[model samples]
Target: MVKGAFDGVTVLDFTQGVAGPHASMLLALHGADVIKIEPPEGDWGRALGELKGDHCAHSIAFNRGKRSIALDLKSPDGIAVVKKLAAKADVVMESFRPGVIGRLGFGYEDLKKINPKVVYCSISGFGQTGPYSKRPTVDGLIQAFSGMMVMNKMPDGTPWRQGMIAVDVTTGLYTFQALAPAIMRQFRFGEGCYIDSSLMRAAAAYQGAKLMEWVFSKGNPPVLYMPAGSYKTANGYIMLSAMRPHHFRLLFELIGREDIANDPDLQSHDNRIRNAAKIIKALNETMPQKTTEEWIEILQPKDVFCERVNNYTDYLQHPHVKATGAVDWIEQDGMGALPVANIPGLPRASEHPPQQYAPHIGENGPEILRELSYSAADIDAMLSRGGVRAPAPAVKAAD
Candidate 1:
């Protein structure tokens, strides 16, 4: 059996985009019965994705352990349905713009009235009370606005957003942390509070060292001081992070050059900066004498740290990943094997298949209302009043 930690908690997840979804993804894996609340046409992801065999591959990957419910909160009937669902829910997560949910009558305050103990978490761009609270943001935009981009730019000076959505991941982890404490609060004191987690803020927090220096010292902390990043070798690049002075001494000695190591100008932090270019040039020249393998063999023996940067495919196929059983595979009807990256402790194989794909718009609307004990007449009335609309594609088997 797939044993989980959060076995009995019920989560009404209204999060979408990246960060919020990843936060709930972890909860679902740990056995929270997360009901994803999509709009009548479904979450924008299902429609706005790059498709593969039977679904949006990205959405399927991230939302593997949750159930879906399509609801149109713009309508009074739909909003009332949500209030009822939230009444029994232990947690409610929403990533809407600051005032959007309030205008729709499903804001944290409104939900709190229904369930005063609900751990309500709001994930947004800037936060609930900031000047940019309602600024529409995506991962790339926030990376730019938060200065994460500048910290990891190209040698030529053009900043780059990372290949994957880094800010989203940071924000998601923050959301999970916030929800955990709130859930613990409910268990300990019988009350839960709201968490205002902003993806922009989390991204900035992750890059605080670089950001703080720019704000306080007015420039980038030198590559020489932090001694962060890669050095080219005969065949590939090996990372170096000799942030401490003693380590710099050890690293210089390993490269077979102790002349500059104890030189008066390179002896201390301030002295190193006064002679930055010379130190960087000597290290670069010495690095290429050995391949990454040779450097690893030499430095690791002395405990002077270094690592080879691996690409995503390499990381997924690495020995540790396979040993940990970190990825799960499924067989689809016509498509070849689909691999779902499974977090540990979830049943690797089982009677229940991986969550069948993101639900079509309103595909589960009726069932969701019914689960909340809504009468058939009430559901029909809501539909008649435009509380929900089924996606035309869902009506047919294929799109």
Candidate 2:
């Protein structure tokens, strides 16, 4: 097999929760040596998964390609251990409240003196420099701040949070983008960089459409052309929109109602908005006659750009998804390989599999300290100083 891109890089992951760990996971997936440093209690993600296993499914997704070591930063020996690792590490990823790491004496300033080539990344909800930086928040808080909570309206007209930790997960991806370049620059430019990866910043990017409209249009969206949502088509529904004047024409053409296309009353963007109700009525009646499949085939081919609003299961099972290999399968503990969606440019082989189990809290302490070149006496002193912890054995996987 071919070697992966980041085969020799070493990343010391000090992040907890989703955002930071996710960044480490990406680095690990592509073949970096990601050593996840956790408190004696382990990452909270290890517990969030519904199952009682050491590896929570959520944690597994982001931690597959890493090793684990437990250290207590508050302890002098633990601080010494991590500082020693920092001296040798190329990248250090942490997701802590603003001043926490600095107080622990492992901040970028503190680490850079020991290792000038170390790229230190901080992932947090607000950012490292904001007044709210010290205030702890979760994905829900980020969604509310980013206005994503109301972007999608439920059938009940209630605003709801994004279904998953969209904020933390995407923020992780953003961190990777920031970290990788800095790592390269450290080698070429000879100085590492400090990065602040904020969930709010990442989530704000998701509002690009609304932001673009507000910027260019100089006010609220043409609620009149809010691309008035979904319409009924024969057989199944289609996500019909009359955003542009031309799309209206396409809608008319697709429905075999050319009269509306030429009508002066229905020609302009604003006019379509005024009459969206009537036009939608006609489209609703016409669309349901054909199956969603039929219209998707015929209209999309005609550049009408129509689609069925499929349920999650239906979308997952859709032939196009399978044909494109958009989803792949993974092995579960009790179950065999189960379907998992392949992310964009997702690894086919080089990527590590999802973690099957989290290391027992502090499970690898002795081994990790050994790799750090700590002598047995030194390691025991740290352990004695409350710098290290060793957990009980993990549930071994089947052979």
Candidate 3:
């Protein structure tokens, strides 16, 4: 049995929703003992989309491979339990609004006193010290504020957010990247650090090149390449990129528009951009004559970078996807079977069964309490007093 990279690490996770939980989930998948501290009701992420028992798609996707304990932060007993956990944790993460965790006595500064080698990470919307730091925000709000909506404008020029929680997921990845290096530094130098991660910063970093282009071009960046866009076909759509001059020429020739390919005015990329309307109009008139699959078959052999616009179902069932083992089907507890995409650098879900199970709310409370040296009576008292919560015993089927 080979150990994972973080096999000896312990993480105390007090974050909810996508970003923070996503980072902790990655840690758990890497064999860290991640203790997810949630409110009695559960992490609010579990309420995203349709709920299935104590889990939702978003929650399960971002919270697998972690033990859970539901606790009321306002209660003294709950705070004590967290403090005890913090003392032994190699890492601590929270996603509270600025100053809230500090007031609760679990901020980086507070925890550093008890455990100097703890790498504490705080994730927020606007970061720790800004005028908008306290302003409540979610993935959509960050998308709007960070110019992602503007960047991803519809053809009609309407600013629209992405269909998915792009900013939140990206923030989670950035947070994990930050934490990994900090943990390495701690192990090497015996010094702890604080990570202030935010959706705003992560979103900005994600669009760094675009921002630079905006500034350099004074908000009028030139088109990257000519004849690079999605065209409607008879059946559906095909996105093609004839970025290089030779590719552009080849595309026109393949479409049986030899006159357009030979046109001197549209030979260069700059001229093509200037006469984009002409090129687009020609493509629009011709593309509808063929189905997306037909166009793919015709253009792919000619070295055109083209792909059929696929929905989720199409992508999931793609032959290449299956051949590459890109997704693994797992029986998620309470949620039944689901297709889990394998992370590029991590082991597949089938290789690590424990990492594939997402815990229900407080699902491991009694076991965690026992590890913390709490007696059965004390654990029962905490549960009875509403300071802690554990899942109800499962009812057996009639024999």
* lDDT digits (tens) for residues 1-399 of candidate 1: 556668889999998877888899888877788888887656665533665433565566556667776677877777787878889999999999899888888788888887888898999988999678888888889888877777778978899889887888789988887888788889789997989999878987888777767867768466547356688998888898776898888988888889867777788887777787777788788889989989989888888889876776777788997787776567543334666666554566333465434444455677777787889998788778877554344332242
Ranking by TM-score: 3, 2, 1
lDDT of 3 by residue, 148-177 (tens): 898898878898999899999999999999
Residue 196 accuracy (lDDT) in model 3? 96
**TM-score leader:** 3
In model 1, where do residues sit more than 4 Å from their true spots? 1-3, 47-49, 53-57, 75-77, 209-220, 223-227, 244-246, 256-264, 324-367, 374-399
lDDT for each residue of candidate 2 in 1-399, tens digit (9 for 90 to 100) = 346567788898888878888888878767788888898778887766564446556766777668888888888777777887888898988887888889888899998998888888988889888688877899889888877776654756686887788888889888888888887788788988889889988888767787777678875455657245676655556786566778778767777778777778777777776776667667666767777787777767767656688887887899998898787667755334556666565465224454323354566678888998889998787777776876555532232
Candidate 3: how large is its RMSD? 2.1
Ranking 1 against 3 by TM-score, winner: 3
Sorted by lDDT, highest first, which candidate order results?
Answer: 3, 1, 2
Would you estimate the TM-scores of all the predictions? 0.81, 0.83, 0.97
Question: Which pairs of residues have clashing backbones in candidate 2?
Answer: 55-358, 233-287, 233-288, 234-287, 234-288, 234-289, 234-290, 235-288, 235-290
